[model samples]
Target: MISVAAIDARIWQAIVAGAFVAIGWIVNGWQNRRVAAALRAERTRDVHRALYAEIASCLANLDSPEALAAYRDAMAARMRDDPGFVPLIPRERNDTVFRALVAEIHILPRVTIDPVVSYYSQLFAIEAMIADMRGERFRALEPERRIAMYEDYIALKVQAFHDGHFALRMIDAYATDGRNGAMEEEARITREISAGFDTAGAAARAASRISSPGAVRSGRSPE
Candidate 1:
């Protein structure tokens, strides 16, 4: 038979070994969670960079009075020929990646997120306006009135131009410098657009440039 003292010592040793195993398991779980979280964050950042770069490219493509001119020319010709034409708005952003990472967008820093979301939100509005213009009711309006309606869309184009510039700068900052730099760049771009840029005048110039042979399609970069 085993002595009681000897039996108690064996039991205590077993208990100590089991406690060590449990502790190790817990530590491993914690380490795995931390690493997973880090990986998710890195992936989110990468997605944001790709999306941002696309938006920056779109901004570069559309920020010119020439691009807006092309659209106006196309619309004027469409009004004359197609008669049921829906004027094209200049919003060439790619949102497929953005939709794919919807969950990660919520986790991103708000300073950067705000600009991106704002830019896309305006695009959504432009899309809605486009649909409305294409509807039967808008097309039924007199040709002169139709032209006037499309001219009123100058507001949307001008606002979008500024929004694109601001958002792209914010995205570039995050990709290049950092978030703090992104916020600063955003603020500066907003001020610059607000002060020196004549939104109405630019739209007017673009519209004026649209002349005879207004067959230029939207989406082509200006020369």
Candidate 2:
């Protein structure tokens, strides 16, 4: 039979061992969580960085009508290849948020005061019209009506492209006329708007909200 003292000592040893094991498990779990969170943040940051770069490239190419049209076509192709690129899906709240943000930024008079603003405004109007037509309520419309709406959308897109080209030509003319300061001002405003949209904190928050597990089920994410 074991002595009482020995029994008590063994029990204490067991308790201490268990406590250490528990602490180790907790520390391991915490470390794993930290690593996973960091990886997720890195991935999200990369995605948003790519998106901002694409937007900046598009804006820069607006100076060339051919490039603008090419960009638009590339965007349309991407939308076709990746349904996620289309903002029509209700579950894709980020898409809608991005579109709304772009529209709001475009409409701001600070940047829109330039002649190019008219062209962008028209482009945004077409985008809004397309969004409306894709809404759930519009699904019940007759086939013919849907066709007409689509035709109108195409027409608007083409007209906006032409207008954008014309605006680019005007910008070129201004450059030739030595109104370089005005062009510089426009470029500065564009950079400011891009910076505002691409701020790391804001993009991180937006990505976090969109990628949250709860957002997947809700079809919407918190602002």
Judged by lDDT, which candidate is best? 1
lDDT of 2 at 184: 64
Alpha-carbon deviation at 185 in model 1, angstroms: 4.9
Tens digits of lDDT, candidate 2, 1-223: 8999999999999999999999999999999987766664443333333333333233343333344456555555655565433334221121332353453333222221245556556657776886786786556665445545555665565555444433433333332322443356456545756777422222223323323232122111001
Q: Residue 166: error of model 2 in Å?
A: 25
| Candidate 2 residue spans exceeding 4 A from truth | 63-125, 128-223
Taking the tens digit of each residue's C-alpha lDDT, what string does model 1 give over 1-223? 9999999999999999999999999999999987777765566456555555555554544556556767766777778787666554433445666667777676556656787788777767767777777778786888767877776665566566666555555555554555566667667766866798643333233323322121111111111
For residue 184, give model 2's deviation from the true position in Å: 25
**Count of backbone collisions within predicted model 2:** 0
State in Å the error of residue 66, model 1: 8.1
Error of 2 at 213 (Å): 30
Cα displacement (angstroms), candidate 1, residue 218, comes to 35
What does candidate 1 score on TM? 0.62
